[model samples]
Structures are given as C-alpha cells and as structure tokens.
Target: MKSKIALLLFFALTAFTLLQNRKITGVVTDEYQKPLAGVMVSVPNTMISTTTDSLGRYTIQVPAYALKLTFVLPHLTTQQIDIGKSNTINVTLKTGRINLTEALADHQTVHRKVSGSYVKMESAPQTFMAPMQRYQPGETENYNPINENGFQVASQMPVTTFSVDVDRAAYSNTRRFLNNGQMPPVDAVRIEEMINYFDYDYAGPSGEHPIAVSTEMTDSPWNPGLKLLHIGLQAKTVPTKNLPASNLVFLIDVSGSMSDQNKLPLLKQAFKLLVDQLRPQDKISIVVYAGAAGEILKPTSGSEKMTIKEALDGLEAGGSTAGGAGIELAYKLAKDNFIKNGNNRVILATDGDFNVGISSEGALQRLIEEKRKEGIFLSIMGFGMGNYKDSHIETLADKGNGNYAYIDNIQEARKEFVQEFGGTLFTIAKDVKIQIEFNPRHVQAYRLIGYENRALKNEEFHDDKKDAGEMGSGHTVTALYEIVPTGAKSPYLSKNDALKYQKTDASDIGKTDEMLTLKIRYKKPDEDQSVLFDMPVKNISRPMAACSENLRFASAVAEFGLLLRGSEFKGKASYRDVIARAKTAFGKDEEGYRSEFVQLVKTAETLDNRKETAQKD
Candidate 1:
C-alpha cells in the first residue's frame, strides 16, 4: 500500500512538471552601457540557460516548477538575482577585474547588486549541466558496424523480410566528406538511404491504400550473369492545405558545443524555412536544451509568425548538452498539446551530443520507444560535424518511428525544410514492412543491396505489435535485389548442404511464370492494426541498356555505394561506368538533385585516384 502511494505521488509530480512554462525576455550590457553579445544568462541549478544574441537580447522558458532565482554568469563577473514576480529580467554587468572562475566561487561577491537585473523564483527541474566537453580529432563521431547482407541460396532462404527505410542522412553526410576532399568511412555509407535519397518517377497510389508498389527486372549492371530487381513504393500525395493540423514542438540544442557558425547559426536559417509554411490551424512550441532543458516558447498559434520568429531569433548557444532531458521535456509538451488525429511531433535539431543525464543510446532508444507508443512521433535533424553522433541519432530515428535528414549546409537545409516540408513533417502511414519471396526455379541465389539494420524476423512481419518504418506524404522508397539466375554462373552464390531429415529442394513448390511475390504491410497514421497486401512479379528481365531510367539510376547509386565501401560483392563495377550510367538516367532534371549526385561521384572518383597515385609513389 505504501509503495502504491509513492507511485501515485510520482505520477502527480510528473504531471505538474509538464503543466506550464513562463517566458523571461531580457537584455544585457556592460557598465559602459554597451550591449554584451555573448554573456551567459542562466537559471543556476536548473537545465534552463541561453546566451545573449548579437543584439544582446535573450528569451528563456522557465518551467512553472522551477525555483524563482536567475543568474547571469559572464566572462567579466558573476551576478545573481532573486525571483520576485516579474516575467522579464533585463541585466547589466558589473565592471570588475575579478577572474570569472574566481568570482563565481565568492558567494557574497557573486550575489552583488547589478543595475537592471531582475529575477523570479517559481520551479526547479532534475539536474544541472556540467562544464563543456573538449572537441578534438576523432572526438565524438561514430557509425555502427554494418555486416552487409550476403547471397542466399533461393531453395534454403526463399523469403526476405525487412522494414522500409526512408531516411536520407547518409547521402548528405557522404557529400560533406567528398566536398571536404576526404573519403567517408566505409560504415558511413548506407546504400539504401543513398538510393532512396533520389526521387523516382514511380506512380503514386491511386487505390484505397495510401501506398502503392511497383517492380521491374533488369540485367545486373556490374555482372552480366546476374539480374537486378527493382522495387519501389510511392506514398499518395496530399495538398498542403488539406493536410492535418500540426502540433509541432521544435526541440533545439543550444549547448555550447553548437557555438560554431555551422551548428546553431545554420539551424536558425533552416527552421525559418519550416516556420514560413505554417498555417493558422497549426501550432508550435520551442524547447531548448543545454545545461538543462527549458521551454523558450509556449504553444503559439501559427498565425503569429513574428512572435515565433522572435523566439527563434532570441535563442543563443551556451552550456553543456542535456539531450536526454530535453527529449523527455519535448515529448511531455507534445503530449500536453497533442491534436487528436493531427500531426503531433517533436522535431529535434541537434549535433547528436548527449553529455548529461540519461545520455546512452540504449537509454534514449527505450525513451523514444515508449514515447512512440503514446502517439507522439520524433523527427531528428542533425547539423555540424565535429563530435557528430550518427549511431546515436540513427537509433532514435528507428525507435522513435520517424525519418532523418542531415542538414550539412544551408542549401540542404532549404531542400529539407522548404522543398520537402510535407514529407518531413507529416506521416500518412506507419509500421510499413516488406517481404519478398523468391521462386527457386527461376532464381538460384539473391542478395539485398542494403538496409543491414532494418531486417526483421519473418514471424514479426505479421505481428501487429512490432514496430516498423513510417511513410510520409509524397515520400518514396526504393530497394534492389541482385539475383543469380538458375543457369547463370556467379562467384557470389553460396550453396548449402541438403537437409538430412527433410526435403531440401524447393522445386516441388511448383513453378510459375512469376519471379517472386512482393508483400507490403502498413498501418494508417492513426491506426493500431495493419493492412497487408501482396503482388506477384512476373519472371521477365530487361537488358541493362534497355531498362527504364529509374532502374538505371538506382543501379548507378548501388554501384557507387559498393565502390565506396569496397564491398567484396562489388564484382567488376568501376567508378567510370557508374558515372556514365548515371549521366544517361538524369530524367527531368528539375531540382538538379540527380545532376548533383553525378558531380559528387566524379569528385569521389578523383579522390580515389589521388589516393592510388600517392600509394604508388
């Protein structure tokens, strides 16, 4: 009975924490009456903090449960102010020669009166952020190991099941490496994402279902003996005005590490593009994390564009990252303001650095997994380079049931937030999984191109409770399978011994004109149960040169990825051949994304050649 009482109390306290938040707007200046651009304005002992913007102004969200006191810790001196009922606290610094660390140590001196400084006390949160971490070479970047899928004998393993992946982080990240004239690490190349990053001309759904599937067969580009299977999915498009009302919480990282021009500064420009597309029916809130997570802006109607923009403009980077705590607070806010049957999501813009409380990938994964069940989705947008954590961000995107896009530059940022707004923020279907069953009579062996991390157990395919990928409006997904025909000779094929007690041959399963059967499962955005569907793929193959542009373009991407990773199964693929194939398939170069890809490949080939020349010398 006592334990039950404690549990109830815990729930009550948590409820109180998510209840409300107040905004404090202020400006800081030196004794000379000139505005200070980088002074740290923070609520000591709490996760809430911000630095002065270029204009020497700032706004911070103080949770209703926080203690009323606020302090300004600047480079020159430390000054503490008590919370007295006012929402605005403008500060002016003390003109002194005291060392910053030394002054912070003197409680009496630190609390000395400073003109124009105001404070308010009301609530407090869980933990305080420590000092900033040092960033160095090989500082904080990590990509998880990928054991690429190998060829499977069709008779032994006839079916391949895996969830659909729509993320495009790897493509942009790889571009960053190539632009820097360096080769991306092997594990950094995810061929599935690299392929899906480009837009395909597959027709959209014209049926009752929200997603449509298309398939094609062509001769393998690298190996003449093998066949390439092209599978594509296109989600039905919904007009912007017809889309669901959104309850968006922008969870931004204002940690000191984001002080670089490309980090927090670039994020400001990127989010501007998203904010401009908001409708009056939609709502937005802003939550920032550093030493602690704090709400800088409460839920405001989208009609108030200037108000939203002001809040964004006022945010500045400082303090250590409390990413885990920030995520919890963002989700809490999302739940509190959730729009039933609407788009409720938390968009986290980060460098993926989680240094403070609850920072491990496993812990974050569990947190996101729980939040996803509660109906609020998560979208992670990563920025900056040094200390970027891809493995951690990838886990959150997978478990949180959301898509990811890396904003490497301002242009890529515009492409995502402006050009692909609907697909980035709105979800049409969730838990989308695909299963492909090969006919042993037509195919001897097969290998999936990528998606090493998204493979699912066959039994999990029909399990409604199992989590999968989400598809947004107008989003497209593509996957490739390399097949070794029955009579074709291939070095990649693996043979298995006949079963001792049971039938090993699948020839008795009966032969049909179909090459394989394709099955797709998905749930409506607001649904718990999934709808299953399948289609038969005819056993017909097109010559590589005669295949459609979609097939040819995708093959080029796969070849490039294999070359980048130096995959054992790359066969006789060459960078020059990949480039030539891509040039022929630049269908309708409207956005120029495909053209940019061709140029990127050329740059990579040059880099590869340079390395070879250096090795020979």
Candidate 2:
C-alpha cells in the first residue's frame, strides 16, 4: 500500500509540472510587411530570452503563469503581449509612425502595432515601466563641454556665422536616455541637432544651385516679447540609381569592449541591412581591428552580398582595440581602389574605444585631416553605450569632412544605412557655411540657439581654405535665432557706453525693410571654389499659432532642448507648452518621428518631476 501511494504522488507531480510549462513562437516584421531580424523576445523579469533570426522567427519557453511576454528592440516601439491561450503570435512592429501615448495615457495597457496603426485591446496586465540603469561599475563615457550662447548686442555683433550641421546623433542619444527612464546629461542636448532630427517640408533646390534656402519669422513662443527667425536649407535629393558608387571600405571594431549584446550582435544585424541596400556597381572592403588590424574581405562588388555579410558575421570580439591600425589599412584599401570622381569613403563602426596605438585625439584628428585632403571621406557610425567616446568619434567626422551618427538600435542603423542611403554615402556639397547679418535697424540683440562648436569667425566665412560642414545629398539643415526687436525691453541687452573709434549707433537701421540678410556658401563635391546664395529676410511677425509647421515644430524642439539643459534663457518655458506646441505642429509626420518626440518630451517631464519630488522628500 505504501509503494502504491508513492507512485501515484510522483505521477501527479509530473502532470502538474507539464501543465506549468509552455512553448511560444512568433514572427516579427516591420510596418512595410518586411521581416525584422534581431528583435528580442523575452519573458519579463526572467533570464529566459530568444532573438528573431534572419527571417524574423523566434521561439521561447515560458511558465504557464507568465501572463505577458515583452519584445524589445531599440529600433522599434516596445511591445508586451499576454500569452493567453495562443501558441503562436504574429507581431507587426512599427517605427515612429505608431502612437506611443496610447500605452502611457491608457494606464499600463498597451496597443499592438499594425499597418493601419489602429488601436486594439492587448492581453498584458497593467504594470509600471522599468527603472533606469545608466552605467556599470568602472564605466566612463565622454562628451565635450558646451558653453551656451548668450544674447549678443546687434549693434556690437550684427552678424552671426556658423557651419550647417546635419548630424542628428545628439537627438537619438538623448532618446536613448529618456527611453531608459533617465534624463540625459546636460551637455548631451544639442538644440540644433534635436531640431534637425525631423524632416520639414522645405522646398528643394531647382535652378542652378544644388541647395535651396528658406526662412520663416514669428514671435517667440517662450518669450512673447522677442522675435524668432527660422532658416532652412534643403539639398536636392538624388535617387540611389543615379548616385555614383565605388570603392567603399567598412572599418569594423571587434575589440573586447564591443562584446556587449547591444554592440556586436546589433552591429551584425545593422550591417546586414546595409548590405541588402547596396548596388552591384558599388564595391565593399572589410577591415577589422583587434590587437592588430587585417583585411577580412578584399574589394568585392555589392552583388556578392552574402559574402560580405558572412565576413561581418564571422567577426568576434576579443583582444585590445587597434583603431589606428584599422584606419590605416582601410584607408590604404580605399586609396588603392580609388575611383576618380566616384564615391570613395570608409564607414567605421565602433564604440570609439581606441586604447591601442595612435589612440590620442590629436593623432586621430591629424590622421583624418590628412586622409581627407586625399579626396577620401570618412563616415563614423557609433554603436553601444557605457564607455562610448563621442568626443573622439565626432572629432574624426568633423575633420575628415565626413558625418557622424550614433546607432543605438537596429532601426537607427536602418535609418542611416537604408533610409538615408544616398545621403549617407554621397556628398553633394562641401565647405558649406551660413552667415546671417541681423539688421540693426530692426533688431536690438540676437542669440543663436545652438552650434557652439561650429561657430566660425567673420573672416572664415569668405576663406575658401577654411573647412566647414559638408552637406549630403537630400539632407536638410535648420537654424533658429531669438532677437529683441528695436525698442523692446529685455534684461539681456546691456547698455554699452558710446564707442570711441567707430560709430555705435545703427548705420543700416533704415536701409531696407529687411530684418536680416542670409548668405550661404557651398562648394561642389569636386570643386575648390565655392558658390554663393544670398537673400534678404523681410521684417515680418506672425502669431505662434499662425506660423508654419516648420517654424512651430522647430521652436518646440528648441524649447524642449532649453528645458533639458536647464537654460537661464528658457524664459517661461514649460513642459506643457512644449507638448501643446509640438502636438499642433506635427504636420503629416509620415514616419511618426514627430509623435516619438512628443513621447520623449513626456518622459522627460516625468523624470524631471520625479527628481524634484525626491529632493523634496
């Protein structure tokens, strides 16, 4: 009788165990119904996880009590679905086009991503967001300091000059922080980059010039007492087929520090996406550095996509970082296979950790400066976090006459590699500079919103030898200015004593009805001399509500940046106002980036409030 009882007990427990365990499978794809590789599927609060393969298929085991499964990828909106009684779930993930507020505003309940972007009920239980985790022990990240620009007297400084920067790395980096439930470092917020991250409906170049300039003016939203000026430049878009292509080298970092899941694994997937978009006319070479640098793949046509992807897949993380050696090898390959007047560029994907030979910032700068003069440009794509050397990577891009972008997720990679393919690799114009002369007659003082690092001297504007920012094909650049109209009262405009040498009074005050004169200088990709475009901005002011989507949206971004930086010039700026303004200005945001910006703003507001409340406690 005792033996029989023991057997029965064992059998009962076995049946219960089987009932508690279940297997779930799913396929994930993007909005366009394309398979999305590298999507992470996992059971929240557990170590059990699996990733979608090249075909977007994933399988994971879960406990019967597991009510929800979370899907996370930096490139797409996060999703948490209740397992319920289903054995298979087909997930459709959307990018910025999805409304993130539906989840946050409706408590813990979230909506699934669909082609039409319609909201539907989800099975997940209500839960709070995860806590923030910034850095690990002994981890250090670097960023250059930014000194805010204060109001300048139009009489003393009537003209402001700066290079047109199209790099949007700062905005994406900031989004990473907000998504992690933390406020980004103050220095990380570049107002200009944040504004330029979204595309505006600016007119493209039509006539002789390869670029177009447009302007908008309205009363400042943050400070109703001041006037705001918005300037934009749009480069003519070139289709992929029409773009020149040849001699492309990919310099990859397979160092020990890049062993993180977000580093190497994400990188492989990102590069695969880029490979899919390549043309047969273009050729790619692979150079990897880890302790020492070597060529993995010789110059091969883009038609051999599998060979290139396999080479990227075989890369492993180990040994010390030999960034300098890798750069030398890649540049050598580029120069050897140099295609005259064709696109010859090196795309370097790394975390900017260069501890090996030729690692110093000065050395890197000098190296890139030399390589740039050889008619070879560099594109630095930053990956991973914690120990990310942004200051170092940005220097290389600025000096090499290239561009920099931080890829925090696979979608960001798709953004630079697939979406902005032509612009990412081909340069339409170089040495692009913008000079704005504020009419002292109509303006008293003016302040530039950002571009502290790209400021140029008055003489540099006309100097052809002076290197400035480069404009990629189909790229758009925007700038903002806050000026106190003549006779307007403000504390920023300090009264200076009468000048002794030159006349302090405004000489061009009544010269024209123009509030400012805009002058842009750019050079053809192969030309040394620059072509100039000049126009005068009329003195016009409209209410913030009546302004164009371009102006309103840009102003809202500028305000959000000021709040992030805790600027003294914020002047009555509030999260509520920013949200309202942005909501109204999200005109035809096809990609939904504008919607994502609003979500980030809300997240920032929450984080800021939490900090304030904790301090009070």
Candidate 3:
C-alpha cells in the first residue's frame, strides 16, 4: 500500500512540473497596429526573460508560480499584466508625445524637389545668370541678348519664403573691435553653435501626430516696434518596442592628439558602457586609425560581449591620424556584413584630428558623401580638448547624412546610448527642412540665427535633392525671428534711390496676419521623396508673460546664440534679460540643461565685461 501511494505522489509531481513549463505566445503592437520589436517579456521577480522578434511576436515559458509578467523597453513606460492561466497575452504600447500637425504648423514647407523652373534658374549658365547674381527685389533687369525690339527685360529677384529671428543672447556675446583697433584676447572656448541652438527633451507623443508647434509675432530689430512671426517646432518621440538588430562599427581615432585624458581613454570607457547594453543578436566591429587604418576586430556577435570589451581595452593612443584610411576600412566592413533592412551604421569616434591621411576637409567630405550612397549611415562622436575641429566634425556628419555629438564624459554616453536609444539608434525620419515666408505687410527684414552656413537659397527650400539636417529621435530645433510692423519705429533699412525702382511701396506689403507662412519637408527613413507641410501664421499675440515653459526656454536659447555671434540686433537685450528668462522657463529640469545654461550665462557675462574693459583701455 505504501509503494502504491509513492507511485501516485510521483505522478502528481510530474504533472505539476509539466504545467509549470507551459509556453505563452503573443504579438505586440502599437496603437497604429505597427509591430513592436525588441520588447522585453519576463516573469516578475526573476531573471527569466525573453525578447520579442522583428514582428513583435514573443514566446516565453511561464513557471506555474509566476503570477505576473511585464513588458519593458528603454525610455518607454513599462506595462505589467497578471498571468492567471492564460497561454498568450497580446500587448500594445503607447508612443511618446509627438504631434505632426502642431509641430509643422509653425515651420516652413519641406518638399521633395524644388519646382522645375526654380531648378532651371539655379542651374542656369553663368552668362545667362548675370541679372540673377545679386538679388534686387522687383527690379526689371535687361538681358544682354536683344529681342526684336530691344534687350529683354525680366524681373530678377530671388524668391524667398521664410525668415527667422536672430538670437539676442548670441548677438550680444560677441567681441567686436574696430578695424586696426586693439583686439582682445581670443576666447577659444568650445561652443557647439548647432547643438546649443535648440532645446529638446524626450517627450512622449502628446497628440495624434509626431510633432507640435505654436507660433507668434513679436517686435523686429530692423523695423522699430514691427512684429515678426516666431515659430517653434515640438517633435514627439516615437515609441520603440522591438527595434531591429543593430550592426555597429566603431571607428576609433588613436592619433597623437587623442592622447589627452579626455580623448582616447574616455572613448574606450564610453564604448564599453554602450557594449554592456547590447543583446546577443546585435553585432559590433572595432576599427582603429593610427599610423594606418585597420580593423582591430571582425564583426562579432553581441553575445561575445567580453571579446568586444577586451578589444576596446587593448586600444592605445599612438601614431599619426589616418582618418581617411580608417573610414574606408570601416565602410568596407559595414558593406561586407550589410544587414539588409536592419540598422547598419559606422560610428566614428575621434578628436577631429586627421593630420596624416585624408586630412583635408574637402577630401574627407567627398569620401563620406560617396560612402553614404551604399546605404551605410555614419555617426560622429567628438572627443578631447584643444585643437578640436568642430567644423570638420559638423561637415562630416552633415554630408554623411549622420548625426554629430560631443562626449564630455561617461554620463553623456549613458544619455546618448541608454537614455536616448531610440533617437540615437533608430532613424524614424530624415532630411528635415524648415522654410517660412514672411508677409510683406506684417513685418520688415529678418535674419536667421546660427545656421549661417545652413541657409538655403530661397529656392533650395523646395529642392528635394538638396540635403538638409537630420533630426534624431526626440531632438527639437528652435528658431526665433523678430519682426517690425509697417508703422513701427524700428532700425529697418528703407530702399534708397538705387533700390527705389526695384522696391515695392510699403503699402504693397501685406498686413501682420498675412505676414508669414511656414513650410516643412521630411522623408521617412527609407524613402527618397519628402512630404510637404504648410501652415499660415495669424494668431493674436499672447502676453509674453504667459508663454509656456517650452517657449520661454527656447527664447533663452536664441538669446545665447545671438550673444555668441555678436549680432547687431542685440538692442534692449541685456545679460539680465537672458538670465531672468531662463529662470522663469526652468520647468521640471529633469536633465538640468536649463540650469546649466544659466551658469553658462554667468560665464558669458564675465567674458563680455572683460572684453569691454579691454576696449576701453
């Protein structure tokens, strides 16, 4: 009887064990019905876990005692569900706030290609372009070739649609000296005009779309008291649940210039942190450029994390820079293991020192431009101090259709890799361009702050072939424009006798409501053509006192840009104004970026006062 009891007990135990190992399977999606890949599905309170595949399908064995399961992705709000006896649980995740209509409303239209006529004009031969050379608004210029009656008269003025406000802070901060006057010491502080140009944080999708914006018109510097439209764009973060596998190639610059503590050494540590987060399917390749370019390690699976870590550790600073060779080798490796339809990228980490090979800016640019055609994306991580080439790095990133970032420390690496994984790794959209047309009636002359080099010819705004900047996930760019009304007593230039015949009468310009139009153009990551977005600016002015935290913060950033550039339009803008604006705009301060800007302002004040004193002496 005892033996019989033992056999029954054994059977019951075996059946329970089988029940505990039962499998659960389901597909994860977003509200849009798009599959969410790379989402983590795991039992609560245990190391047991599984990740979803590209199709958002997941399968995991659930132990009988497991009462709950959780789905998690970096930067996403985590979700948990109770697991009673269900064999499958389908999950859907909400994306971060990004309202497309709202964001595009305040910017200019972005189109795939400029109108054919505009292209023909831009590409016209030098002989036929004499009249188009210097823009004279509404002038009837005569063509050299005589018609049956006489010289052909044609209106020759560049068609411009948008205007931007210069940053007051940046304009005031610059040190200007009269010609042949005693110049102050050059303040070679490291400043990224572009990166410092805007304020963007990772916010979830707020409305139905991926971008949002609010625009207003304010006083212009050129025209006294005249108001101009100040438009702002707020892009929403895309929800990334299960992203595809990433094949990353790390091209390291170990040149002599990178021997600084903040250069080569910091690079290794930063990359190591990135490696710790890699999954088994992800692959990494290490390429070093010193005396010559060579691959330190072939593409290895992320499962071999230790191997990558060891290779990174073995890297040492020595020899001259062969940036050209390094890039070629890295691109070759990327092409060899091209992961079709996956994230294939070459991340170049350097101090911008390329002295020995492919050092010329033009040569390097050409190489990067050519390689981009192969479907391999590039990303540049700038490091180190003294002799840093911000321009070089910027050009490379721009032409390669990639993003550029400066790494001041390891914490920044986390922000780039772990915190902003989606923005940094995934390309949801590309080639974003903003163009705004100012109504002649609403305001007077305007100037765009910073992007002096990025300014497109009036017609280039619609040309799709012309490359524009790429916005990473959750990245926000802000532009401010000050406008003067027709009757406002601002410092605007009136058409003199030379321009009198070409100029339109002040009465011909439109009113404030019709003063400006915003246009935006962008393409999906895999698309070649861009979509157009347009919005009219006509809202009544809000009390400057009631602007949202985002608006105020953006204003402060604009001011900083003006101060740096030493713009002539810094009238009535004091250091006090910038600081006060920043203080009021400091909301939530999640990353303390605003607070840091405040400190930067203090430093800027000191610099400005010193320069003033030198001028007096």
For 1-617, candidate 2 gives per-residue lDDT tens digits of 99999999999987787558688888998766777666767676654566676567888878777788877655367788888999998898776322333332323323332331223244432212221134543567788899999998877788899998888899988987787667888888888888988888899998999999998888888887999999989999988889887689999998887776557667777888888888998899999998999999999999999999999878778778999999999999999999898989998999999999888779888888888888899999887788888888887888888888888766677678877888788999999999989877888889999999899998899999888998888998999999899779997777777557754566734668898889999999888899998999899888888888999999999999999999989998999999999999988765567877888888899899999999999
Residue-level lDDT tens digits of model 3 in 1-617: 99999999999998887566668999977655766555667665544566665467888877777788777643234567888788989987653322222322322221112221111233211111000011122432111121111110111221243312111111111111110021211222111232343454434447544555567654332234544345565555655546667789999998776765456756776787678778777889999998898888999998898899999878767678899989989999988998877778899998676778777889888788777766678888877544665556766877877776766544455556666666676665566777766554444455544455455676777777777766555656566555444444544344433245664555654434555667877776667788777777773566556656665666666655455545455555667778988898877665444665665566567667877998999
For residues 1-617, write the lDDT of model 1, one tens digit per residue.
Answer: 99999999999989987767778788876555656544555665544666565456777777676555444432234567664678877777753322333433322112111231211223322112122222344755888899999998887788999999999999998877776567888998999999999888988898899999988898887887898999999998889999999999999998877766557766886787688789999999999998999999999999998999899877778788899999999999999999998999999999888899788878888899898988899999988787888888888988888998898765577568766789988998999999989988898899999999999999999999999999998999999999999768887765568667754465665758888999999999888999999999999987878888989999999999999999999989999999999999999755456777877888789899999999999
Q: Which ten residues in a row have the lowest lDDT in candidate 3?
A: 124-133
Using TM-score, give the best candidate's number. Answer: 2
How does model 3 score by TM-score? 0.66
Q: Compare the candidates by lDDT and give the number of the best one.
A: 2
Worst 10 residues of 1 by lDDT: 109-118
lDDT of 3: 0.60
TM-score for each model: 0.78, 0.86, 0.66
lDDT of model 3 at residue 360? 83
Q: Which stretches in model 2 have alpha-carbon errors above 4 Å?
A: 1-38, 42-70, 74-89, 93-133, 136-138, 501-503, 506-508
- lDDT value, candidate 1, whole model: 0.81
Error of 2 at 9 (Å): 20
lDDT of 3 at 53: 51
lDDT scores in order: 0.81, 0.82, 0.60
